[model samples]
Target: MPRIFTAIEIPADVAQTLTFLRGGLPGARWIDPENYHITLRFIGDVDVHVAHDVASMLDSVNRAPFDLRLDGVASFGGRKPRSVFANVAPSQALTDLQAEHERMMQRVGLEPEGRKYTPHVTLARLRDSSSRQVADYLSERGSFRSAPFRVERFVLYSSRASTGGGPYIVEEAYPLAAIPAKRAI
Candidate 1:
């Protein structure tokens, strides 16, 4: 069974910017910008029928296009940094969309993620790091922030390999309603 997850794809321009941010971190395997995404929920491998059910149920989520801000840099694993990611700011629209997605998935048979959802786009996965190292890194860049961009759609991805850079196929794309051109914050 493929490792499946629901996510929102990053735009090419944003992806390129993230790609350039890679490097300098030893023992880390950075994610290719092309693979950057905002995971709404992750549903582990399941039978073909379940995949279909998830896809169908996800079809019910109604998320309007909203802007997202990707700012700041951070790592996971405290002393032993296991991964790193760029935090995504959660606007009410973004939060509501993810909640609706999770709720719809549960109705269709996928388990809830349990933890409160904090939006972020993963930038890399660390091979190893000490707790001190992780803490130090965060302290250095904790204030990191970025300009926001419009989110037009989200996707369903299938992780087909463990290469850390293989094919994460976009099995489906769901579009949010277009934002009004005149609307301003």
Candidate 2:
């Protein structure tokens, strides 16, 4: 069985920008820039057959490339601040793509994802940072935003099952349709 998930790769330039957010907070285990990604769906350990079905079904997704931006910074686990992340600006295309993946997983017999989809690229896993520490950090860098980046493809990544934030391997990639050029009137 392999642990896998679908996600949009962050461009190198954007990843470099994100790297600046490293350090400052104690107990923050910064994620490697190479592992930064906006996950579409997390499909936990599955048999070979289900993995093959997921890979095959993902190729059937039909959607045009869309732009996404990292708009702000935030943390999860309000009081305890379990993790920090770069917020992704809302995009219907992104939401639709994620929803499609959710539906596809169910079609493959996986349970519906229990949590509401909150799209973000995690920056670090907090071990003992308090709410004040997280709040102060956010206050200082809350206005961070990245230039819009085109998402031309999404990929299926496999990772060793362990605590999250990892050395993920791209098992396969699925490209989105190119946006058609406008015709001059």
Cα lDDT of model 1 by residue, 1-185, tens digit: 77788888888888877766666666668788778888888887788888898888877665568888887877756556778788887588888888887887788777778887878888878776565655665576567666678888888899875866536899998888844566577
User: What is the model-wide C-alpha lDDT for candidate 2?
Assistant: 0.95
C-alpha lDDT values of all predictions = 0.77, 0.95
C-alpha RMSD by candidate, in order: 4.8, 3.8
Q: Give Cα distance to truth, residue 68, candidate 1, Å.
A: 0.3
Clashing residue pair totals per candidate (backbone < 3 A):
12, 0
TM-score, per-candidate, Cα-based: 0.86, 0.95
Sliding window of 10 residues with minimal summed lDDT for model 1: 129-138
Q: Write the per-residue lDDT of candidate 2 for residues 1-185, one digit (tens) a residue.
A: 99999999999999999998988898899999999999999999999999999999998898899999999999999887899999999999999999999999999999999999999999999998989989999998888999999999999999998788889999999999954667999
Off by over 4 Å in 1: 135-143, 161-166, 178-185
lDDT at 49, model 2: 97
